[model samples]
Structures are given as structure tokens and as C-alpha cells.
Target: MDVIIARHCVAAGEDGLSPLQRDLIEHPARIRIAEAPTGAGKSYAFQRALRDRGHRILFIVPTRRLAQNLANGLSNDLQDAGWSRQKAAQSVAIWSSDQTAVLRSQGVASINGVRLLQMTDLGSFDGGMIVATPEVVSGLLIRRRVEAGQAGEGVFDMLEQFDHIVFDEFHSIEARGFGLAALFARLATVQLDNRVGFGVSRISFLSATPLDLKPTLVDIGIPEEAIALLRERIVPDGRPLHGDVRLSLVDSPSLYDLVLDHLNEVVEELAAGRQVVIVYNRLVDLEKDLPALSRKLPEAGIDPARVLVINSVRDSTAKGRHQGGFAIGRQRDPLAYDLILATASVEMGVTFRNADFMLMEPGFEAMSFLQRYGRAARRGANGRVIVRIEEQRKPWLRAVVDWVRERPGERSTIAALTQVLSRSVQAEFSPHNTASTFGQLSSQAKWCTALYWSVLLEHASNRQPRRGHLLAHQPKGAGAFYRLEQRVRQLADEPGLTEQVNHWLKLFHAQAFDLRTIEPKIRVVSDTGEAYDYPRVWLQRETEVFERGIETGDEIHIQGGLDDYWREDKDRHAKRDWICHFPHTTRTLRLPCDERLVNRWCDELEDIDPYEFDWEDHPQALEAVQKLVRLTGLVPGHDPEISLDAVSGVL
Candidate 1:
């Protein structure tokens, strides 16, 4: 079968398109769900199809590194399809925040016309390829809908222009991205149908672990036929043969000891002239452990320079060492360094083929475990994997680890693995009501949604759009839409939550609109409601107080007992009609101080700049601030920057 397919497509690898990719091209689906194990050449499947079909493609990935990797990989594929290397480079665009240096350092930017893209640049991105993080695309969709104008229309049109959009690492998508992707797929169906008088647009979701897209797409209002099409299009490929790969677990009381043992083993391997990849889940952990390990390596008779640490926060050197930005794969030459130290940033999509030895701090989820181990044994390389697990994770993660250890050479089908993971997560988090649980939402999704909705509510409140706005997409029902509306209302009605929401909104909008020149005063409000008087003038920075013998940052609860000190301060600082009741430490009682002070402290927190606020500066003042802020409601005023919005045409 492989030989037959390879005969058909001259450009395909010796193994040719996996049966999944082959089926996709032969019988295309409006919404395709394809599955293939890691190192099964998933990247080139769509790359080949789009290049041959001459279709514009939008490739969405989970991380900036993967974006860079896919951009370069696709460019090479384009060149292979008779495009000059320079022409291929010029035809592709990459969009991500603050990744220019990483791109240039990696030579992703050196290719002729490859440009760094932004939300605004989406309008002018008439290139053949687009590589971006799903988060960026989701934000653009939200911004376009809320801030409807020429800019909004431009984004809508740009999205509609894509012939195919591929979501790589589909299992990594959270609720918000999943919702947005499903939404875009629906819109593309309409736009493409209108343009060609039929459904020409194709949406493909590729993942090694299967996800049930029916519920998610249906939740987002995708049509029944589309959902059916997705089910039919699901091409679940068998796992690749991982030769000579052995999986073993190390258990120790202290994680430090576990890592130390692994390092000792790695040093021994390095001394034997074997290549190794050591992956850490946390960059901070790697930074802490690397220094200690490097100090010990000299005694072991191995050059410390042979160790390469790849993290986003490191500095870039000429040899691509200390390169702190997004690394698609092992930045340093695999042959050069006996070991490559990396964080989870390398886990998802990056390929480290030559390194046959892997020391991993096993991640909690099943997909992570698979992807991490999949890094080794690439392109027919035989490898071994060692997972160091802490005592705490032993109880829950042990079963999952055991599952992997039992199947070293054999790979489980995605559907089987998905079932295993679903059970594990359900047992841990939502045993009783697993069906109704808020489906696998990432922290980014929650934060982004909260911020986006706050911006929308604030803008809509000011503009006073028609009562039946597009926001109420669902008829009154107990479903995802109802939950979404409930969340929106909570943001709109609650003061403290609204302020927190606005805080996030302001940061994102600043990036979207380049807000350094604009004053944040309009949207930024004091959490304690005391940053301004009735006229809303910025207050003087209040210095926190620390008395002798008191810790510098203890939280002090104010009882509002009306002592002489309280009376004096109240008389002097309290504003008229501002004695709104804030809750006591216990919500059962009210603290009758000037609510503005507490509100301002909580909302804008003008009294203490969070980033600059020092716990050691004054413990008493820190406690005082927390007591004041905590004495009240769950949310704050979503102060809309009406003037700023009108001027910038974006909220």
C-alpha cells in the first residue's frame, strides 16, 4: 500500500502519505480530523497537499517554536514543489508576539520575504502560507467582533480568504481556541460556498490523541452535516514503530534526588559519547538544576560546554547556544552537545531525532507523556526513555506511567489512549459529573475570554447597541451559550471582577493598538475606589507604613471600630456620600469606611503597584491594603475608555 501511494505522489517520502493523509486528499471532508503518532510525518501531509493544490494555508500551532518550525518546514516543502527557496520564503508569513529575534537567530527571518506578522497585518497578509499561535487568531476574532469598524471588517475578510486552515497539535487546544476555530470553520464554509457556489474550504484538525470534536463543534453551532463530515473524515493512523525504546520510572522521596540521579546517568552516557535530551516541565527548574549539574560535570571529566540549555528566556550566542527564544528543536547541534536540556516548550511538535537517550520529568497528562517520549527515536532512530516521578505524583500518575512502560515498542491507537486519559482526568477532577464538566479549558482560554468579554461589555455599554445584539447568539437555553452569557453578565455586573477583567483587557488592547502613547487612566481604576475623588483625579501615591517589630508585609484586617485614630482619618480623608459599605473580613458584617479607598485599592491598586510593590517595604501597609481590598465585592467597575476607543476605532 505504501509503495502504491508513493508511486502516485512522486514528492511523498519513501513511506508516502500515511493512509490518513492519503484518504484526506482522495475524499476531502469539510471538517477533517486526522490522527497519526508523533514522528509519523504529520507536518508534511498538509504541506504537500496545499503546495500542490496552490491553496492559501493558515497553519495554527500551540507554541511559537512550533510556529517557527512549521514555517521553515513548509517553506522547504514549497521549494521542493518547484518554488525557489527565496520565493518559498517570501510566500510564507509568521505571526507571533516579540519573536523577531528568535526568528532571525534561527534563520526563519533570513528567508527573502518572510515577515513578522501582527493582528493588523492580517489584512495585508496575501501570502501563500501563514503560521501562527491559535491564541493570536482567537484574539483577533474577538477583537474584530467587539470593535466593529473597518479594522474589524478587514480581519473578517482576511480570515475568509484562506482556502485551508490546519490546526496542528489539536489536542492542545483549549475551550476558547476550540470554540474560535470551530466558529471560523463555520464562517469559512459560508464564505467559500458563496465564492465558488459550493463548499471549497477545508478545516483539518491533526492530533496524536483523539478528541471528540462533535460536542465542541456542536456547542459552537456548527451544522449537523459538518459534524458528520468530521466524524467521517477522522483518519486515525497507527502509532509508529519506536525501535529499541525502553520506558522506565524512577521514584524517590525527593524530586531533587531523582533529578540528581538522572543527571549522574546522563553524565555517564555523555562520557560514553552518546547523545541525550533532558527535558524539564518548568524552565525555572531547569535553570536551577543546570547550574548545579554544570558545576559537577567537570569533576565527572565531561566538558560543561557540551551541555546545551534551551529555553525562551536565555540569551542567544553565535553558535546558537544561550539562545533564549523559541527553539523549534535542539538549537545546538545534536552531535555537538552530548546532552540538550530543555523545558516543556520542546515537547509538543519539535523533533529531536538524533538523540536516542531521553531523561524526562514526566508530565501529568497522557498526551504530554507521549509527545515527550516521542522526541527520541525519530526518523527510525532507536532510543530509550527514563521518566523521573516525584513521590507526590506517584499515586495518580503511576498508572499512566505503567501503561507506557508496558507498551514500549507497540503504540496505542489514539481512540484507546483518549479513553484512558479521559478516565484518568475524570477520576481526578470530576468523577461524578464528568459529562457536564467544562471541557478541558486552558488557563489562557479563561483569562482571554474574561478579558475579551469585559472589553465587549464596556464598549457595548458606551455605544448602547441594539438590545438584541449578536452576543446573544443562542435562544434562552441551558447550554454553552447560556454559560457564556452568564459569564458576560457576571463581568458586566460585578465591580471587582469587572476591574480584573479590564486589567487584562487593557494589557491585550495595549498590544493590539500599541497603547504606550495612550494614557491608561481611563480604563485603569483604583481597586479600593480611593485612587480618585469625585472628579476622578489620580491620587498621590500612598506610602505603606511599617512600625517597629512588625513584619514588612503582613495582611492587617481593619475592623472599623471607630477609634480616635479611625475617626480622625475618616474625618480627614473620607469623601461625602462615599461611605458605601464594604464587607468585613467575614462577609456577614459590613465595614463602614469610605468604600472608595478600598475599591480603589482593589481595582486600580494605585496604592501599590503590583509589579513594584515590595513585601519587605512595609508589612503593616501590605496587610492594610489587602484588608481594605478584600472587604468588598467580587468585581469592580469596567471603566470604558470611550475617548480612547473612538480615537483608535478599537475598544
Candidate 2:
């Protein structure tokens, strides 16, 4: 079943990945789960899992941006130790949406760059290790071929074509729409028979905090032996490491400015030739700020191309290694980029390992806080992280601070993360403590928690979701409708469908339902009209209270911004961040009305008759609120200008 992929990797001749990673790879199990603390050498563990398990390999990551780093790491580090060229071609392959149709149609090479050619244009390749985002791999798993030879059936047939699969960030598996991860979970149980009968699926699930996975793994049917191998149960978190790291509060009145100042210093250092990683909580800030950040670095003597910025927004936009753009001018050493600014992309792979200092943007969740900080000290070097929380955000950041202060071990970040997940981390576990990710104490001896861990181990070791599945997103709660209308009115100009818009108002008089779902409400009180009636705070977009951040459903933390002028300022700056009720297509949005943007938005929407668009087949425009959010990143709140009832019919 295992096919020798191709000769591509160039060994760095380094000692190897960290100890934890080494243990992960050497494990003989065809499938396993491995948990490491925040900094417990999981990335290195991923490599060994890929190497010893034959040549064919696949790595899945939670973020598209992280896939590149995974690709880079696998290329340099995946050596046979003492094997022939033909013996070493099967560790990894990278398949991203960005790969041009032609390149994907023709076989593409692994990072080592040996285009072995495919059996067909698409399926089955020998020995190649693949790096893929969740969706792309989902498309591949259902197919009969890949970078190497043709595939048959059964889990072994699937496993035969590939030596192993690993996923990074195992805790992220979820369901929002038909994500690759969700599909894999569904199939792993039903099709693969809990990954047992078919010896083909050797896997490992890895995570810093594997708490949330207990329920997911339990849902699937797996046994105890498999479960024990899933999570190694390494060190316990919260043991208290005697480190010199300290947390500082930034009481800067101008919080944004303060963040910029700190960011610039890091950038200056990067320009001065020190590699660094910068993590922020929200993608919106990174989106609007990165271009400016990149612009500022060159003046400080940093090469713009050297710096890489990774975020959810960027992941949605990354075009893969097609057309071979950089195939020629490959640099001998890393370039001089002052720093790599990222959202959650810093959470994986070898990319951030070269640096030991970190600066985190404020107002992020506690678990994420730990993950970002973990990016800094790794590979046996002592590192420190500096945090700058806002004056008002102190209360919320306390959980994260306490977790860090607990100190599981001086170097055992994985343990610290475990304690946080077990105690400090603010997460909603459906089946509380009775069920752990390692093994379940449920009535059914099937061991669902271990199964979940098995999935994570496979994912962690593969650095890829099983069969290239993506981490799923949970379904979010929608808000009231009337408020959604008001938000739409404020953000967008009077749309072209005023007639239908008026017709929607008539429904108010004949009110059929007393609120079908939690969609926000919107009433059309004219500019000169009197105050309207709607629910008090019906789905207000989560605010940055202290200007720290503002994501949809993030909880609006207004600092008396609504006392008096708040009424007039309702629509003002609201479009800059927004909340959408739909799942992934329209999950979360940032609002702040921009007349310039609206004008541009209108121009884009004017020609797009939502009536003529097919959301399933095409992603044209999201002018009408009902249009599936496939076109835009996420759906915005209701548009009072355009009625929801009317949008339902037209879209």
C-alpha cells in the first residue's frame, strides 16, 4: 500500500525536533493521540509520526496560513536519518486551494521539489508527504487517487495510499456547515469502523488542551488500547514554573497608539535582523493594520517581502504553490523581515520557532492567549512573552494571567495549557469533567474521549486533519431581527429595493410570529423621525469597550458610549464591525459604517440582482441579507434598508 513518493527534501542536518515530538513519531501504532503542553514540542512530534510510518504522509492544520509553515518544516526536517533517496520520498505533500488548476491537474512536488508526476492528473502519488488545508483534503479523500498510485477501498485501502495523517490543533474539530473535519468525524465512526478493523489509518491527535474534544471523541466508537495511545498524559498543568516572565498592564489612554508603538519596536528589531512573531486577537485589526505595518517596516530597514502576516482573513485569500512563482529565486537563508504579524496562524508549525520573544495584542480569549505565548520559547531555548492588556480589559484577561502564573513547569508549556483547560480556560464543555479527552467513564466502553484524542493525535502527528479535514466551527446563535434591520440601515445607504422594503414594514402590523429566531430587529425611523421601538440591546455586536477589539457576538463592552450620544452614534462606526446569524458563510463580522465603503459596496451590488444569483453554484454578492454568505467572508447584520422577509423571497 505504501508507495515511495519522490526525492525532494534537503536535510538541515540538525539534531532533530524536540523530545516530545520524537516520542510521538517513534510510537509504533498505526494510529495514536499525543498531547503536549503549550510548548511541549508537539511540532517536532508531528515529524516523527510522519517519518517512521512509511513514505506517504498528510498533515492537516486548523489555519490555511499555517499550512505553509508546516510545508517548510516538513521539507527541511523530514530525513530518513540513514536511508537511500528512493527510500525517503514519502513523508509529505501540500495541496491548497491556491494551487492552479493546471498544477493540480498535473502532479505538483513536495517542498523538497521532486515532481514525481501522478498516476492520473489528480489522485495518488508515491512517497509524497502532503500539506493541505481541510477542504482540499476532504475533496481528495473521497477521490480514488492522489499524488502517488491509485486507491481502492476500505480504511486500509485509504491508509495504503498514504502512510499516515496528522492534525495540528486537535481541539478545534467542530461543526458549522459541512466542514472537512466534521465530515471526517462522521466517516471515521461509520466508514472506518472506529479506525480499528482497517490497520491502514495510523493517526495521532495532538493538542495543548484537549478538554473540548471529550464529547466529540465519545460520540465515536473506539476502544481503550486506542484511547491510551491517543493522549500520552504527559505532565499535569499548573505546577508553577519558576520563570522570569512577567505580565504588564498597558494603561495607555490611547490604547491603539500604545499597541502601535510596541509593535513598531518589534518591527524595528526585525528590521535590525532579529526574527520575531507578533500575535493579535482579532483579524479585523490585523486586516486594516497589516498593510500599514508592512509599509512602516521598510523605512526601518526591513525587507517587506521577508515579513509574513498570517490570519483568518489571509487564510481565506492565500493562493497556493502553482505557477511556481518563487520556484526560481529561492533564498539560501531566511530573509530579513522585522516580524511576522499573525492572528492565530502563529499557533502551529516551525515558522515561529526561530524567535523567542513575543508581543500579544489585547482582548483575546484565554486559551488563545496561551497558544500565542507558546509560539515564543521552543526548541530548548529560554524565551519570554510580554502582554499588554487594556485598562478595562483587566477583568477578562485575569483567567489567562492566572493560568500563566500557575506555572505547570518552567519549560512544560503543554502542562500549563492542560491546567488552564482543566481549570482556568473559559470554555463550555457539554459533558463536563466526568469525561476526559484521554478516556471516557461513560456507560458505553467504546471510549469516545479516546477516539476524539485518537483523531487529535492523527491530526497532530499529521499536522493535518484526518484525510485533510478542516477544523469545524460551532453553530452560533442568531439575534433578534428588528435590530438587524436598524444596523443594515446605518451601514448601507438606502438600497435600490425601497418598494420591497416598505412592504416588509406592513408585516409589523400583521405580525405573524412573536420572533421566530434570535435575529436582531430593525425599525425604519427616518433621519428626522422619532425614536422607534425594539428590544433593548437585541444582538449588539460585541464591542471593544476599550477599543481593544470588536467581533460579531463578542459582547459589546461599551464604556458609557451609549449614555446619551450613543443614540445618535448608533449607526456610526457600527458597520466597521457587525454580527451575522448564519453559520460559516456569515458567521462573524466587524462593523463601522464607511460612506466610501457603502458607495463602493452599492456599486458592486447595483449590478448584482440577488434574484438572478445562485448562491450554491456561484458566490456573487451578498447584497440581500438572505443570500448565503458564501460570497463575502461573513454575513453582516440586518439591513433596515432591505427587508429580511423581502430578501428571503428575492435571494
Which candidate has the top score in TM-score? Answer: 1
Model 2 clash count equals 103
Give lDDT tens digits, candidate 2, residues 468-496: 33223111111122233344333223344
- Cα RMSD for candidates in order: 14.5, 16.3
> Per-residue lDDT tens digits of candidate 1, residues 1-651?
000000011123354655565555544556776655556566676676666655566778876667766777777767776888777776677765435455677877332123313322432333476787765564454443433233223223445566667788777765433444544554444323235212345677776654545444544455546542322222323334344455567766433465566667766666666677878776445655554565665666666566666655332222342222212232343344566777766666876536767878877565676677777765544556777776576433766655655665464443344445456655654344233121343323322233333343343222423122224332112233234334333332433445543443243333322211122221111223211111111110111111111222222222221010111121233222221211111011122224243455354443333453334544443344343224212122222323334423444
lDDT of model 2 at residue 82?
Answer: 59
Show the lowest summed lDDT stretch of 10 residues, model 1. Answer: 1-10
What are the runs in model 1 whose C-alpha is more than 4 Å off? 1-15, 23-27, 77-82, 99-127, 139-155, 176-179, 189-200, 228-241, 253-274, 298-306, 315-338, 394-396, 401-422, 426-650
TM-score of 2: 0.53
Task: For residue 205, give model 2's deviation from the true position in Å.
Answer: 1.5
